[model samples]
Target: MAKSQKLLTLCIAGVALMSTTSGPTTAFANDLPANLDQASKSANQLKWVRYTDPAEGAFSMDIPVGWQIQGGMFRFGYFDVRWMMDARSLDAKTIVRIFDVNVPPYTLPTRYTGRQGQPYSRPQQFQMMVSRYLDGQSYAELYAKHRFSDSCKIMKPRTSDWVPTLPASWKDDPGGRGTQGSVSFDCDTSDGPRVATVFVRTTVYPNGLWFAAPISILSTPDRVTLAHDMVQHMIDTWEKNARWEQYQNEMTKIGLDRIQAGFQQFMQQMQAYHRERSAAMNQQVARFESQQSNQAQQVSRWGETLTGLQDVSDPMTGTQFQVFSGPKANYYVNGNGVKVNSDVSPGAGFHQLTP
Candidate 1:
């Protein structure tokens, strides 16, 4: 297993530093009690009951009587399943199907049966069976098909195994493996005494056999008829129930809904980002145009100041010279014969042509 730790540094302006550690230390104390022995004992002594609502298209055994059922199925790749929590056990108890081991009810089209003792490879039979679950929708159809066979077999061996049950107070965790699948439970049935949930996992294979592992959650007492009921439910109800088809369909829909929601959110964010970028680009272009316009006006003013120049001939000596003047009497004259004057101006009143 590869584990990577990431550290993030946050800087808040003008905020007082309350503590240096960013870890969730306070939650650790409250989440688990101090006495391990008491906790263990309490977990074993708990009792839970079951409930069913056929109208809701869902049924769970040995769940806490009043716990709400978030009635739905979810799927990831080849696996499709449903789950419920026990209310009396603080929603601690749970039940889930890791795989369906029942073979398809269709006749074998070829002599090569894919069952372990078959003489030849039953590729056609294998493909047909896998096709039912895949329904021509998955990207990796063959892979999922193979997984169906592998996971089904692993789940077969441990189905009827019995173990101690958990108390009604402690919750069960079908510990997550991050990839495959897990289901945990704590329940009391009319026949089985009390049983802590065992984890069920499945692995699919391409050849034919579907392997599954159904391990008891180890310490749950065999109270009432839970163990027997659970086993029978697996072989009788789960495998034979027409409801599995609906469960599969629901799971497929849930997977698609998740994908669609993700895609929609991605597109929305991208559109917003693009709009912001376009606005920024337009602002930059506007600033550039304004600067160019100002530069053009400066050049136009320079051109106008230079346009006022004219060549003039002196009346007294016939000396020609270019002279330029502005509105404020600022002007330049170019000629050697122009008379030197102490001061020169006219209209604005100037004395000129004085030696």
Candidate 2:
């Protein structure tokens, strides 16, 4: 199989694992101490720093002071599908990953089939598709069936119901409406069976744009409860930067404008092509008419045909010129034969000039 196909398969499998839902084991819920609510509240007392992306200024998240942050692109084929932010503690035991998913025009799929092997017909089908992919297995059963790594042996899978309670700071934030869930398990490492917990929160937008954050922590059995608490605390502090949202809206508008402009250009090209062909036919008719008509009449008809050809040729030439003018600007001619400039800045917004 191709590399891209392999990566895609793994991604699908990960999503399937995340969507799994089965009855929690009785022991799984009882293993952890009963003071989880208090622990989560206490975790908020820890010192944290908000880390924001320096390049696009797209997002920001709060993490404990000692955690290290890293950013990367998740690519499929030659296109980037998502931006990944990873924060790991100094001990490398706890890790949180936030995936910002977006598909640009170049990479957006023309059609998508659900897990049921059929095209979706309704918005609710998405939830059904996820449930179908998971196959009704509990978190523990899913992990046991699929190991985390080549050397890792997942065992003693446990699960508990986790509901995220956002802090007062996020009460009015749109992002706070994200759906959250969690699962816990144990994996055999070099030391032994180490406890691990995973927390996932997904936010789906009305436009079908969705992003998920899956935070996983590997720790000693004794620290499992603390790991769970910290995950909740982190979620409570999650915030979407307002400037980033504004930038995204601007980008969307620019994208739509480019699409509309390109379509208009295509229609203009088709009309010009037809006019050129018609002008050629009219010139042929004029040449035949010249053989049987007076010189003045033939010249007049020929001049009209030539003028029509010139009108068609001018726009075609302008279109070709725009094609070679580089990526700095998108050029289009107005009805008055004047050129308009639509310049776009990278990761910024669009600037349009009057014709």
Per-candidate local distance difference test: 0.32, 0.44
Model 1, 1-355: lDDT tens digits are 0110000000000000001111111111113323322212222232333333233333334332222222222211312222222122222332222222221211122334443223332221111232212211121223233433322322222223333222221112222111123233333343232334343333222222222233232223422244334433322322112464465445445545565567799999999999999999999999999999999978866775678644445545555665553344333223443322223343332223311
Question: Which candidate should be chosen as best, given TM-score against the real structure?
Answer: 2
As for model 1, its CA RMSD to the true structure in angstroms is 21.0
**Alpha-carbon shift of residue 278 in model 2 (angstroms):** 9.6
lDDT of 2: 0.44
Write down the worst ten-residue block by lDDT for model 1.
5-14
Candidate maximizing lDDT: 2
Positional deviation of 87 in candidate 1, in angstroms?
Answer: 14
**Candidate 1 wrong stretches, greater than 4 Å:** 1-81, 84-237, 247-280, 292-355
Clashes of each: 56, 0
- The TM-score of predicted model 1 comes to 0.28
